[model samples]
Target: MEDVGLNQGQVFLSQNVLITPKKGDTYKSSRLSALDLQRGLIMCLMAFSHCRDYVSSVPNKNLSWNSPLIEQNISSLDFLQKSLISLVAAGGFYMMMGIGIFLLWQSRIKDGVNPKTIRNYLVCRGFVLVTVQFTVLALFETIAEGQFYLYVGVLFSLGICMMMAAWVMYGVELLKTKSWFGFSKIEYWLPLSLGLIIILFSHGVIWSNHHYNISPDVLQIALLLGGEYHTPMFFIDINFTPFPWFPSVALGLIIGKIVTTKKEKAWAPLCALAFIFLTIWFVIRTANIQGLFFFGDYKTISPNSAPLTWQSYMSISKFPPSLTYFLWSWSINLLGIVWWFKLEQIQPKLFTSFKALKIFGQNALFFFIGHWFIYYGLSIALPYHLTTLTGIITVWLIGLIILLPLCKRWYQFKSQKNKNSLWRMF
Candidate 1:
């Protein structure tokens, strides 16, 4: 990670010659306040989205994120609002996770840690995430909904994907020592190339589900691939399946490499990539051919008009995030990264003044679990009639305010622990 206070005159002496890079060549660190602010905002948005569960006017028991937005008959504003939220919430989280993994791996290597120890720590951390998702977080959901089923959500997907990616990277590390073969090239491109393959194959998975009569017993794999499947014993619901969601993390790793490894500033190249992706997203969505997995037969919103225009055709699915969703979400997220990087450089005090976002980002894992407890507990304690949007907004704000002090305390406590402490897992 580049230090925020990095000196522009810092130079390396090569063969007794001091080489100083230009002022504009310096890049901000990935571990700086900018990244924290982004993470903080994502957590806040996630909490806002969850607040809808108990605070909204209408019941969302059957709301499927897998379904395309066009099918909902929402206005353009509604679609845009949901898209922006989804882009940052789930997608942003996974991408940040990837960046976190890369940074952790790099830090460990720099500190001369044993490879075995580093890999073991990551695997253990992954298990901790999996356990919390299934046990603690599941309990929270059960309490809120008054029902009990295994909670397979973004956290679970994150845990599984993290472990899988860790092992893959470990294997790549092992290959580096073999001079007889050209395995070094696999380190950087493997994750990204595999991610693309998995993403493309996901559309085929959707097609397969429609054309083929897959058996119910085997269909339980939907927890990995996505879509609904049932068994005689239990009902399984998946929000972010592992394979489909892996690309976000994989892309994060690629972006992390760019920001951290480059000798020059990352904003320009990142901005260019963002624009490129934005263009591709627009073209594909306008075509309405590929990049769309759940496009159902078009239907008229009213008796008098042709099937709803471009809005219906362009809207994308989320549950397993279609290619179009992937493109647009990441494009916007990339721009966000560049913006935050610039913000850190131009207005450091303004960036630091958002203390709530800082606390939330510093203790992200704690805030993630703690916020749910605050909101859901409050919902149960309060009157059931408080379902209006205004009511929810008030509740959400109060919940956040309540959480701020608690998150600060948690951050303080976590900071005192050793790097290897179990508390560090949070």
Candidate 2:
């Protein structure tokens, strides 16, 4: 699992010192606890969105971020819930995924593990994720639809990005070994370059899809890249497309590399990045321009339908993730990382309260897949019981109560397994 991205023995900064725990040792660092707290909180809050989708009386399609804010049927509460859920989940998860990759690379490389072996393991783990997406995760959709509904959701896109990250790491290693001039900061430069280029490219593709009459062949390809798709083959939905979302992972890698190496010095620059991203989001939204790395201007919303306010304007496009969405999401995400780190040190008791829920974060992959089943199962068994937003949230709370102990057990089981164990794939 260390080679594939879940590295429990990762390096973290504690009290301005860099600490990499020994193999089979524990992390006493607040930074690690903060990360687990953040992840656990994300996983726990994410279930509310899922419960709303499966059990709420409102039609699921009407609950999407793209739906008109002025729609007569959608309650303001539901709209706010869905929008907030969409805002928080993926940006943090993908950033953590990138961080895991770098930490694994750093740990294994320090132990003198072969780079090729690490790359191969990453590729294998990625394919396993893809397989799980198509099989286990797809089972519910296929059975419900009565056809082969291939849904390319988060795990599928993550697997593709993981494979791509593997190759990128391999190339960095190759350059380090074979190049004439020594390249010291290749890791930082590479992912940063790739992330920016992909962001620009994805924005362009999405723009083109909106304005152009694309052929079916190109449209299918666009589906894999970052554009919305329409096809008659069964029923399909891609929650995340590989290319556009990969930037989050890339950005995480850059941050992880810096924090693990530069230690405390990383804090200033990270805070600055969060500020810059926030500024860009505000400027772009206010400017109301829709070209060259921006899309879905705030003013584009139908003015006659409803009174435009700050809240309405802030609810930007999420699916296929417009540049504004990425900027806004990651700005908050970056701030959270730094905020958590500081909070843990200044207020240990409060941090401990949150860290107690780290069971959900520690076993995030398991919790992610298991939660879908739990909520969906609840929907079937208790059909029509969850008619209100309160009931939906009640179900979400109950699901977390059930998942917490289960996640703890799973974490314990996973802990005993060797690095090569297949259980680590979760």
- What are the lDDT scores of the predictions, listed in order? 0.65, 0.69
* Tens-digit lDDT string for candidate 1 (133-162): 999988877776556655687778888778
Best by lDDT: 2
| Residue 262 lDDT, candidate 2, scale 0-100 | 65
Pairs that clash in candidate 1: 2-29
| Residue 287 accuracy (lDDT) in model 2 | 60
lDDT of 2 by residue, 253-355 (tens): 8877877776655667878999999898888776653223335431244445655455654556665566677787788777877887777667868876774
True-structure RMSD, every candidate:
7.1, 4.9
Q: What are the models' TM-scores?
A: 0.83, 0.85
Q: Which 10-residue window in model 1 sums to the lowest lDDT? A: 1-10
